[model samples]
Target: MSRLVKCENGHFYDADKYAKCPNCSRGAGPKKDVVMEGGISTDLDDVKTVAMNIRGNIKSGRSVRIPKVSGRTIKPSNEILDREEQRMRELQEKIRDHKDSLEEQVTLAKESYEIDNDKTVAVHVFENGIEPVVGWLVCVNGEEKGRDYRLIRGRNRIGRDSGMDVTIRKDQKVTREEHCSVVYDEKSNLTFLVPGNGTLTYYKGEMLRQPQQLCSGDAVEIGETKFIFISFCEGERVWKNEEE
Candidate 1:
C-alpha cells in the first residue's frame, strides 16, 4: 500500500509502492542507524566484556567447538539434556529410600527392656557353669517402689545348724531412716541376711509375715508384723548344697 511521506525538500510525497526514491537514492526514513546501547553497570563490567567478545566472534563468522568423549557422540541436544535430568532425579529417590531402611534396622537392633522395681523375678542364663547373675526387679509388691539404686554387699558366714559355711546371694540393704521392709514372694522359703536389728518382714501376695531372718518360701515377723519370703532368680542354674 502507498503511504504519505515527507521528503527532505520540504515536499509531501504520495507513493503507490513503499519503495526507495531513485531520484536522490534516498528512502522516506531516518538517515543514520539507531544504535541501541544497553545501560552500563560497574558490577557487570566482566560480563559485558565477555558478551562483547562473543558478539565480535559472531560478526567475524567464527564457529564454536564442542569436544566428544569416548563412547559418546556430539554433546546432547536440549531434548537429551532434559532426559538426563529426569534420570538423575530417579536415582536420588532410590538412594533416599535405601538410607531410610538402613536407619530403621539400626534403631530396632538397639531396643531393650527397662528395670523398674525391687522384686525377685526369674531370668534366663546365656551360658551354664558360670556363677549365676541374680536378676531382681526394682519394685516392691509387684509395684515400682524403689527410689534409689544402692549397691550393697554381703559375705557368707558359718551356719549354726550344719557346722558348715553358709552362702547366700539374696541379701538386700536398706537404710534405717527410710523404714523400708522386705516383701518376699518366693515359694521355697529360702533365707537371706537383713542389715538391721529388727526381724525382717516380707509380703506375700495376700498376707505379710515377720521372721527372725529373711528366707525363701517363708515369711519373717519382726514383732507383730509379718512379711513373705520371695525367691531368688538367677541367670543360670547351678548346684545347690546346704553345707556352708
Candidate 2:
C-alpha cells in the first residue's frame, strides 16, 4: 500500500519506491551534494550566490553596492526628518508656554493675598478702639535702656518718678515728676514738646523756652536722658499747634 507525499516543489506523488516526486523536473527535485576545494560538501541547489562581483570589488578597496530591501534599507528623506524635528520643537514650545502660564497665575495669586492682608490690617485698626501708634520715643540714655516708649494721642509725662508715663531713673538731673510733657492734640492733629516751668529741656540742640511743635526725627533731651522721636503718620497733613 503506497501513501501520497508532497515534495518541496508542491508536487504530490505516490511514495512507492522514490523518496522525492518523480513527476517534477530534476532542477526542482531533491538537492545534490557538491564537494568544494575545502572538502566541504554543500547542496548546490540550496546555496544562493550574488550576481555582482563582490569579491573583486572588496579586493580593489571599492565600496560594495548592496541591493536595497523594500522597507528595511530605505532611509527617510531630509524633508521627512525636518518635519519630525519641527513637530518636536512645537511640542517643546507648548510646554514652555504652559509653564509660563502657571508662573503668571502664581504671581497673581500672591499679589491678591497681599492686598487682602493689607485690607484686613486696615479694618482691624479702624474697628478696635486701638489708637494707631503715631510715633515712638527711643531711649538714647537711661536705666530703661534700649526700650521704646509709645507716643499715642494723649499727654505723655516724662520724669524720674515711676508714676510718670516715661520714667528716667538713671539720670539724677531729671525731676521727681513732670519734668516735661509730650502732648498730642487730636483736634489739631499736631504734637508738642511742653517743658515744665523750670525743667531743663532741649530740642534740636536749642533750649526749649515754650511749647514747641514737634515733628518726626526730632531730638529731645530731658536732663541727662536723650530720646529720638520717630513718627509713623507719614504722608499725612500735620497741623500747627497754636499757643494760647
Candidate 3:
C-alpha cells in the first residue's frame, strides 16, 4: 500500500514515503548509502532508518540511536541462577529416588514370584524340617477371630510368643511361650492336644488334664482364644513322606 510522507523539507517526501537527502536540515543523522527508491534522490537505505532517526531526535533532540531491545538480552542475576539450579537438583533427586524404589520393587517381585525367564529358586521351608501342614487351628473366638495356624508333622507349640510354632498374638491370656501344644502323629494320622504346665485349657467344652485326641471341628480354648481343629491328614488324604 502507498502512503504519504510529511517533513520540514518537502522534497524529502513524496506520495509514497519519506526520503531524506544528505544536505537536508535534518541531516544530523548518519550518512546513508544511495539507493534508488521510486526515482527520488536520497542516500538513506530505507525509510525505516529515517523513521528511527526522527523518533530518536523527537524524544531528546539527540542523534539517532538504537533502541534498548536491539542488542543482547540482560543476563540473570547470580542468586536467580543459583535458585534455578537448586530446584533442578531437588527434582532430579526425587526422580532418582522414585526410580530406585521401582527397581527395588522389581527385584523383590522377581525373587518372590516370577515367570518363565529364569530357574526359580524353590522355597524349602518344608524340606528344611519345617514339615508340611497336616492340620490347621482356626480361631473362632478372641481378637484373632478367623485366623488359621498351620499344624506341622511335629509338635506345634501354641502361644503368643513370636518364636512359637503357632504364634497367636492377639490373645494376651495365652502365655508367652508354650501355652499349649498340638502334635500331629504321622504314624497314626491323628492330631493330639497336650495341655500346658500351668495354663488352663478347655478341649471339647471340658477342662483338659492330659494329652487328648483332637478331631475335626473340635473346639479348644486357651486364654481367651478358642480354635476349631481342621485336619488335612485324615482317612484318605495325607502328604507323601519321601524320607519314610
Clash count for each candidate, listed in order shown? 37, 0, 0
Of candidates 3 and 1, the better by TM-score? 3
Candidate 1 on 68-184: residue-level lDDT in tens?
112222455778999999999999999998768655543332221112224212222123524332222233331223321221112122111232222111233322231222222
Best by lDDT: 3
- Pick the TM-score winner: 3
TM-score of each: 0.21, 0.42, 0.46
Candidate 1 local distance difference test against the native: 0.33
Please provide, for model 3 over 1-244, each residue's C-alpha lDDT reduced to its tens digit, 9 standing for 90 to 100: 2233434442233333345443354564443545443333443434554565567566855554332211233567889999999999999999999868756654443333222323211222345656477889998988999889888675677788899988888777888887878877666778788765436689998976557788898999988888899999888777764664
Q: For candidate 2, what is the TM-score?
A: 0.42
lDDT of 3: 0.67
- lDDT for 154 (candidate 3): 57
lDDT tens per residue, model 2, 1-244:
3344556764444455467656465555655556644455544432321122345456756554433212123457889999999999999999999868756654443332222334434432434446456678898765666878887555677887898877777788888887777766555667778766335789998986556778888998888777888876444654222331
Give the per-residue Cα lDDT of candidate 1 at 154: 22
- What candidate 3 gets wrong by more than 4 Å, as runs, is 1-130
On a 0 to 100 scale, what is the lDDT of residue 132 in model 2?
58
